[model samples]
Target: MARSSTNQNVHSADDSSLDAGGARALRRGLQLLDALLDAGPEGLRVVELCRACALERATVHRLLATLQASGYVATAGRFRYVPGPRLGRAAAAPGQPNMAVRLQPVLARVSAAFGDAAFAIVRDGPHSHCIAREVGTHPVQVLVIQVGTRQPLGVGAAGLALLSALPDAQVQQIVAANAPHLAAYGGMTAERLHLLVRATRERGWSVIGNHATRNVLAVGMAVRDARGEPVAAISLASTLARMPRERQQLVARTMREALAPLAV
Candidate 1:
């Protein structure tokens, strides 16, 4: 897990950076948000938060009160704060400049390699969303996925790669959560998903055939964030005839090369 980062609005240049009046308050407020983000879905109590952010109890309370009113934080208990519903609502909204725009060029490069469609997928809660895509120029284009398509985090090759990169405990948690929903997709069970995740880990990538979509095969690898966490992935999808085991390896290597510079 990422350490409770306090560098968001603080840790900048000294007093000359901004006007003296409300700057300190702003820094403290951002520190509070950072600490709360690190606490995860379970959240942290007022006392725990105070210790994490190194702020006074009263100041933490004041900030929490303000944050709650602004829909940035929500109380789990009398003194605990979890991320608010507004954050989730904002996440699915389409107006923001998103990963697809940044990755469009990279996706084009991957698609060009073998005339197979490519996708950029990002983890959103327990699902991996196709945020960007580039269609191959081949006569038979494999449109396995498109921008805004979403699948359970362990379902598709791209999603499985992302899931395999997560910790074991978190993997189990997601398995449990998605187990109930998997039946609707294809009678997929958590146990089956677990097996795929393990295989993906050993292979350092994921490959799927006739699973999510029949006759379509895909190769995927996770991309790490600055924190070294798998936040996204790139995938190449084509007909099964085009993506043999040897070709899968080749495509994966190509994906790594094309996406390496973009990860930064």
Candidate 2:
């Protein structure tokens, strides 16, 4: 009876300790979130938040992921954090159709036509962010991206298209800033991205194979705003067997035609 009582006491102590640890983690997460809210849409880099919150790098990354999953924090570029939609500050003004809303039909049409996943991506500073997505009728669905996912300036097909549209000087600056983050993605480096920029500009469309996902191929093209600046991009993603060289060209042309009348 005495031994049983002792074991119970030990278990109770462990439970208390775990509860305390959980509470501390929650408090730290809130601190990180507060830091992001103060940073606003302009956002703050992970290192900046680590300094501001006096937290370790790994801890800050974990907290940011938790907050982002809950819609409290959003990533802008590779590691930059911004206040998310849950904060109630919409990016759109009153009466202006949001870019996501305006592009939904376009994405749906592309997905339906190609029987693959289609995405709408926009330029967020030096990053490309997936703002909307559409899944096709194919039973074997490949969901590689979702809304709010952010990629470096030249990392993915959408990003490559966006980067290819920029002038040489601006591309150099953005590529330099994103260089360090590129290594994390398999075979992606600053030099390689510059090569992709050249090829994408020459082809008038970006083609990425097996980079974002194994054995998946994606074709992308930039959508110009009213001023003729490439402000956004659209991509069609399918298996390698589906996107042959000939099919890629055909899809690129179709994407250009579909997005021609889009105002923004």
Candidate 3:
């Protein structure tokens, strides 16, 4: 009886030690996730994460590996890490409905002003998901992207605007990831997308043609969250002839004005 009691005690102690170790690991992992969430889409490198979480490099790496494997975190480039598809999926559960409903008014105002179709899209991992759309009173409407449409980031004017707002390093990483699918869209290539990103940054808005839709031109501007992070994009689309250089500028300005009062 004495020997059996000693064995049981030893087993209980072993289990207790394991439970404590597991709990510590879970806490460290949660800390890393908190840091990533606060970082938003811009993400952070391993070193940055180490500093943010105040954890050892090896500990962060192990936790990140587990998170990445479970799809809670993703690599932005060779160095930086961002929230992954699983995290986005979790947010989508409570986020998509609110985002779609809230942006309807903003889309309506922008479309009403421009007399064209206005669309709102949010970044979903490497893709852009159209959550809301409003059609204007124009006789000839450009309905390129509809509500619920999903496309690779940088494929459409709205998506491109969001993409251009990301850091250049993250941009390259996304472009490279989307390279294989670019050919299906108007022969778009990594090189071409990079050029467009540069142009969009320089112009302070985004314009793309013959890509999302044939013979259609779209102008887009990014909508930022309170943190000034690009969270969504607003775009207006029209026929190529209706969106000449001068008209594009006017549309961009109109969108900016309409969105000025937007809280998000």
TM per prediction? 0.67, 0.66, 0.72
Query: How much lDDT does candidate 3 score?
Result: 0.88
lDDT of 3 by residue, 54-155 (tens): 999999999999998998987765567888767865876444456667678888987888799999998766778898999999999999978889888998
- Of 1 and 2, the candidate ahead on lDDT is 2
True lDDT of residue 91, candidate 3: 78
For this target, which candidate reaches the highest TM-score against the unseen true structure?
3
Candidate 3 has its poorest 10 consecutive residues by lDDT at 92-101
| lDDT per residue as tens, model 1, 1-264 | 233344532544444466664788788888887887888855678898889889999999898888878877765423457676456456654764556676788889989988988888876556677888888989998887788897778778888898899888667766776777786655678888999898999988998767778888899899886678776788889898888889999998888888778743
The ten-residue window of minimal lDDT in model 1 covers 1-10
Local error of candidate 1 at 79, Å? 18
Descending-TM-score candidate ranking: 3, 1, 2
Lowest-sum lDDT 10-residue window in model 2: 84-93
Candidate 3 scores a C-alpha RMSD against the true structure in Å of 5.0
Native-referenced Cα lDDT, model 2: 0.82
RMSD of each: 12.4, 7.8, 5.0
lDDT, model 1: 0.79
Q: What's model 2's TM-score?
A: 0.66
